[model samples]
Target chain A: MEFINDLMQYEFLQKAFFTSIMVGIISGVIGSFIILRGMALMGDAISHAVLPGVAISFMLGINYFYGAVLMGVLAAVAIGVVTQHSRIKNDSSIGIVFTAFFALGIIFISKAQTATDLTQILFGNVLSVRTSDMWITLVIGGIVLLTVVLFYKELLVSSFDETMAQAYGLPTRAIHYLVMVLLTLVTVASLQTVGVVLVVAMLITPASTAYLLTNKLWIMILLSALIGAFSSVVGLYFSFVYNLSSGAVIVLVATFLFVLAFIFAPKQGVLWRSIRARKSKSAA
Target chain B: MTGTVSVKNLHVSYHGKEVVKNISFEFNSHKLIGIIGPNGAGKSTLMKAVLNLIPKDKGKISFAGDSVEQVRKNIAYVPQRSDIDWDFPITVIDTVLIGRYPKLGLFRRPKKSDKAFAYKCLKQVNMEEFADRQIAELSGGQQQRVFLARALAQEAEYFFLDEPFVGIDVASEKTIISILKKLRDSGKTVFVVHHDLTKVVSYFDELILINKQLIGAGPTQEVIKPEVMNKAYNIDFDLLNQMGVGV
Candidate 1:
C-alpha cells in the first residue's frame, strides 16, 4: 500500500499516466475514421515520415511537434497528389515517400553531435513526458474531437462516397484535405505517449476492433475511445508493476482486444458466425 | 415539367481524340428519351457532357433556359454501377441519404422528415428491408435498386441513368422500367443510355441514335428503321438480323 501510494506521489508518473489517457482518447477517436477509411498503413507511413521533420526541428532548436505536424501534412498531400495524378498505386507512393524521409531522418540523427537517445524517438519513454507536451496533447486532442463532431455528417458522406459527394456539390476535395490534416494532428499528438513506431497501432487497432462489434459509426467511435482508454490504463498499470515499455504494452493490449473482438463479436465475428451457420445448417 | 435541354454544336474528346463530333439536340421535359448506339459510339460521352460531368471541347448546354450551375438543383444523375466502388462501407439507407444531400444544402443534417422521405423512396423500390445492410453485401440487382431509390429521393425534374439495367435480373429490369415509365408519366424528363435494341420500340417514347455524331432521333418506331439503325450502329441490318436482333 505504501509503495503504491509512493508511486502515485511521483510527478513524472502522474504526468505520464494523464498524458497516456489523453493520447489514447485522441488517437481512438481519430483512428476510428482512419480504420474505416482503410488508411492504417497510411497512418504508419505518416508516423515514419515525420521523423526527418523532427530531426531537422531538433537541429534548429524548434518545437518538434510543429515540425512533425507540418511534415506529416506535407507527406499526406504528396501521397494524395501522387496517387491521384500519377499511375502509381497509393500504397507504393506511401512506401516510397515514407522510406525516403525515414532514411533522411536516420542520417540526420546519426550526424548530430548532441547524440540524443534514438530510442526516445523510435520507442517513446512515457515517463519522460513534460507538462508542456501533456498540455499540447490535451489541447490538440480537444480541437480534433470538436472538429470531427462538427463535420460529422459531411465527413461521413465524403468518406462513404467521395464521387457522389462531389457530384452533389459537397466540396469533397476540401473534405479530403481536411481529413489528412486531422490525421497528421492525431499522429503528432500520439508521439509522446506511444512513440512513432507503435502510434499507428493505437490509431488502427481499437477502432478496427470496435468496427467488428458495431455497424453504427457513432457507436463505433464511442466504443473505440473507451477501449483505447481502458487499454492505456491497464497497460500503464501492468508496465509500472512489471518494468515493461508502456507504449508497447498498450499496443499489445489493444491488439489482444482486437483478436478477442474478431473471434467473439456477435454478428460479424468469425467464431460466432461460423457456429451460427453450422447450427442453422444442422437444424435444416 | 416544362424545362427544355438544348445542346448546341457539342464536341467532346477523350485524351485529345474527338469522340463526339459536332452534335446538337433539344429535349423537353416529360419525354422518355433513349440514346442508342453501337459499342464505342460516344453515346455515354454525350450524356456526360450534358450533365457537365465531362468537359466539352466546344458546346453550349442550357437547362431550362439557364446554365447548368444556375439550375443545378433540377438535375439528378445515376452513374454506371461499375463506376462506383462497391466495397465502400455504407448502408443502403445512407446511400439513399446522399441523394438528399444536394437538397439539404451545406452545414445541415438530414432531418427526420428527410429520413422519412428516404424510407418512402426505398419502399417504392421495395428495398426498405435492406436499409441497414452494407451496400457491398448486396447483389448486382439489389445494387441497381438502391441507386434507383437514391434517384427517386433526389426528387429532380430531370433524370439521367447510364446502363441501369446492365447485369441485373429480369424482374429488377422490369421494376426499373416500370418506375421510369411512371416518372415519365408524372411529367419528369428521363434520358436513358441503353444498349438493348429489342426493347427500344416498347420502352422509349423517343430515340436518339448516335455513332460519333447524331444519326437520327424521333419517335422510337420511326427512328429505328433499318437505314437509321445501320447509320447509328455502323452495321448492316442483315448482320444484326443474322445475330437474332431482328431489323
Candidate 2:
C-alpha cells in the first residue's frame, strides 16, 4: 500500500516504473525473434559488447545510447566476419569479441573515474532513471514493435527457411542485419532498467516462459510481453519497499514465472507429459 | 508461363574445393526432370546455384531468355526435409501461407483470397485436415506433403524440389509425383533431386546425370543407359541391370 502511495506521489518513481515496463515489453518482443533464430548467445554478446560504448560515451561527456548502438553493431559484424571467414564457430567468435570489448570497458571505467556511479551501468538502479531515459525507452519500444508488426511475414519466412526465402529473392542477409540493428537498439534501451549484465535475462526469460506456454509465435510474443510487464511491476514494488537492486529482483521474478510455466504448461510441461505417459502405459 | 532454364558452364565450389565442376545443361519446361547422382555428388549444389541460394564460382543460369533476377518471383524451391527444423513453432497453414510472401511483398498482409488459395494447395496434397495442427506433430510423409503444398501455393512457373521422395511413405511419394506430373502437364517446369536409381525410369520424363560434371541430360531412356550410369556412379553397371532401370 505504501509502495503504491509513494508511486502516486513521486515523479521519479513514476518514470522508473514506466521505463522498466517499456524495457520489459520491448525486450520480450525482440527476444522472441532472437530465441527463434537460435541467436540467444548473440543477444548475450551484444549486451556485453555495449559496455565499451557506454564507457566511451561517459568519458566523452555524451549519451551512451549512440556509442552503445555503434559498438553493438560493429561487434555483431565482427562476429559475423570471423565466423564466416574461418573454421571457428559463431559462439567462439561472439565470445572473443564481446570479452575484448568488455575488458576495454572495465579498463576505461577505472581509468576515467567519472563522478556518476558507473556501477549502475553494470547493475541497474532503476530508481535513478531520468525523464529523458524514460522517453528514449518509450520511443525505441515503439519503433521495435512497429517494425515487427510491419515485417511479420518476412521475418517469419526468412527465419523459418533461409533457402526458400533466398529462392524467393527476399534478401535474407539484409533481414538478418536488420534484426541485429534492432537488437542493438533494444539493448541500448534496456540499460537504464536492467543494465548490461542482466538485460539478457529480461530478454530471454519471459520469452522462454512464453515459449513453453504456447505453440504459436504471435501468442508466445503476446504472452511474453505480458509476463515481462508483470515482472517489472512486481519487481519494482519489491525493490522500492526494500532497499534492493531493481535489476536483480526483476530478473528473479521473470525466472520464477519461467519455472512455473515449465512445470505446468498443459502440452509441454514435464509433469503433464509424465502423467500422460503413465496413463497410456496403463491403458495398453 | 512455360520457360526453359539453361545452365552455361556452371561451376560451384565450397571451401576452395570444387563441388560442381564445369557443368552445363538446359532443362526444358513442361516436363519432370530428375537430377541423379551419387552420395557426394553435387546435385543439391547445382540446384542451389541455379536458384542463386549459394554463390557460383562461374556460371550463367537463365530462365527462358531472362536472368535469374528477372524471373525470381516465378521460381519456387523446396529444400531437403532434413534441412528444416520441424519443431519450429508454426501451424501447417501458416507454413503453407509463406508461399504467398513474394506476391504480397513488403508492408502487405495476406488477403482472404490468399488464405483460400493456400487451403486449396493443402487440399491438393490431402493435408487440408492438418491445417491448424503444429508441424512437429506430423509424420515424415505428412511433413513432405506440407512442404510440397507450400511449393504448390507459390503458383510459380518453375518448381525445384531437393529429394522430395527420400524417407517418405509410398502413399506420399505417389501423391507428390502425381502432383508434379500434373504441374508438368500444365506446362510448368519441375526439377527434383532424386537418389533412388530404381525409380528413375518411372518418375522422370527427362534426367540430368551428374557426378561433379554433366554425364548426360535427355529423355530418361537415353540418359539412363549403362555407359552414362558407369560414368556418373562409377558403380557396377550390373547393379543397374539388376534393378531393371532399363539400362
Model 1 pairs whose backbones collide: none
| Model 2 Cα lDDT, one tens digit per residue, B1-247 | 2489899999999989999988888877898999999987999989999888888989888899888888888889998999998867899999999998888889999999999999999999999999999999999999999999999889899999999998989999999999999999999999999999888898999999989888899999998888778888787787757887444
lDDT of 1 by residue, A160-237 (tens): 656555555577778877888888888777777678899899999998888888777778888999888889877877
True contacts kept of 1: 0.10
TM-scores of all models? Answer: 0.88, 0.98
In model 1, the runs with Cα more than 4 Å from the true position are A1-8, A111-116, A280-284, B7-24, B35-60, B65-67, B72-74, B82-90, B136-139, B208-219, B231-235, B242-244
Candidate 1, A17: how far from true, in Å? 2.8
Write down the lDDT that model 2 would get: 0.90
Interface RMSD of each: 2.5, 0.9
Flag regions of model 2 displaced more than 4 Å.
B239-247
